[model samples]
Target: MSDHQKTEGDQSATQDSMRPESPEAAAHPRRLKSFVIRSGRKTAGQQAAYDTLWPKLGLDPGTPLRDSRSPGRESAPLVIEVGFGMGQSLAEMALAAPETDFVGIEVHPPGVGSLCLQIQTSEIGNIRIYQHDAVEVFEGCVDDASVDRIQVYFPDPWHKKRHHKRRLIQPEFTAMLAAKLKPGGLLHLATDWEHYAHHMYDVLAAEPTLENLAEDKFVERPEWRPETKFERRGQKLGHGVYDLLFRKR
Candidate 1:
């Protein structure tokens, strides 16, 4: 193989070696995003899911929503749910708040499939999907100040001290996301990991343009975000849940 290809292969090997050897990792994290596919290639399952659900969700090709406005002369506020695993909360929010349009970004296939199935079964509209890295999608696809709210529930904590760099709730990423939100737009983040919860608080507090909505450091989990199976599993093991809500300055 060429030098570039050889380097890529070596990096893949390193990642495979680093993944946890526990059975839980195998049963759940089938393959890391970096190893499974490039940024945008949908697997057969994802493709089938989209094909089945996109129509029901009203996200057909040529859908006028790419620019963050509703069809016709009226414009609707936009909400984005990043790392929306299986999209349960997203669907609930969409059904509850039909006036707002929702865009969900996720990299996992089964999660996307599950969300699509739900959308089709529910016959819901007013949602879109971008099956890619949320950072790139936020910067490239979404317009400045176009979003009214951003929801990120239970993102991968990257719990290891050394792997902390890979955590999604970083200052740079949040800054980019804040720029996409309108002034006073809300950013909602939740986590079940104690260490990562404090990490999120520290990072968001340091960002100059965002302010915590809660009077205290932490906010109670709202009724809206129903606990998922993964979260329930964590809770059964005594993992505490934390939530942080902030508004753009």
Candidate 2:
């Protein structure tokens, strides 16, 4: 069956079920969440990739990621990306940085399937995926001080005033993420929403363990990050993009 067909089938089974508890929530018992489940369709090719490739590339949230090596050599730097939509940029980065091991955490199934297809078609070996809440992945699976870099690009802005509580770059979340980073590890964030950018700056600045790398409040977009489709749409709408780089102290 096609990905969309599978999703449609799965939705019927899950639609009446209560939302699954996040690992973080189970650990700490919190109601706040940065993302909501959305229904999305996937192609037949993507579904095929999920059925064939997910077993090899998927990581269970209950299992901790140990041993950074992928079969042959010494451990390489580990980069974890949160909420990689459709896995385009994550795959691009994995292709560009062969020496770096990449782990992506995303809740959406179609995105995971799309990424699996990319890994299969491109023969990319350095990237693995966790189809779970990023908070849960960080709190449960990721080791403390094990990551070299963390990337959060264009996270849901949660634009309404009341919805601001759902923004991902809050002080508490920043501190939690900081704890998982090795000293001197980098946290890179990019957003087209100016208000969210400022919020990120303030929250990150309050964390004693993190230091902003920008000379000013925001830094220029680094060359390594490819322009995503959402970014292009934002550009067309005259929204400014902000990049923030922070190093763990």
Candidate 3:
């Protein structure tokens, strides 16, 4: 996840001089955007969330994020969820773990608006959002070794063989994700695509700084991740789900 990260790969080749995340990121190889901007219209409720709830929950990626918890919960764990589509599972997770603060990223407006609504109806405070490209959010905003958990649930698979380059779980990016975690911090992923699952496994496995929590190829879905409408739809289609959990070494 730039939290559970997209293109689950990233971007149009970007020029540092234009929208640079930081001087250091620009110094690295030019990056390609993996995910496409999805088009969708928001409901009136969702629009309202953006108008009202956003002021409370929205984040500025240019600003450094520190201690992402409510008052007196200074020691709460920090969790990042990348590509949180529609935000139901993420909002549920926040409710289930009030002791943790969740920072969610999604480039799409509808998803951000949907999540904003969830936060309002649920009346949850520990959840915040960055309605921007997750890549820049991580590179520019989140501090290295600051997060306790990073969860990327079902990023765009970019299923076409030629489009595999657009998949998010690449070597350099996986290495960056590893660097974001505190030692022993957890990285959890879930996908319904079997091919993408293997791809995710191989990329994460190759990261020198990460250790797989499951001895086998996959793990049972953990309790914290509520079953999402998307997952249920996949299930009805006979698609299998795979969960992968790893720890920072």
List, residue by residue over 68-148, the lDDT tens digit for candidate 3: 445786667999988887788889999999888899888878778888888889899899898877777788888899999
Worst ten-residue run, lDDT, model 3? 8-17
Model 2: lowest-lDDT 10 consecutive positions: 1-10
Alpha-carbon shift of residue 164 in model 1 (angstroms): 0.7
lDDT for model 3, on a 0 to 1 scale? 0.80
TM-score of 2: 0.86
lDDT tens per residue, model 2, 129-248: 888888877887888898999989887766567446657788877888999999999999988779988999999998999999999889988877888776787689998999999999
The runs of at least 3 residues in candidate 1 whose Cα sits more than 4 Å from the true structure, single-residue gaps closed, are: 1-49, 55-69
lDDT of 3 at 217: 81
TM-score for each prediction? 0.76, 0.86, 0.85
Q: Between 1 and 3, whose TM-score is larger?
A: 3
The residue-by-residue lDDT of candidate 1 on 203-230, one tens digit each, is 9889899999888877988676666676
lDDT of each: 0.70, 0.80, 0.80
Q: By descending lDDT, how would the candidates be arranged?
A: 2, 3, 1
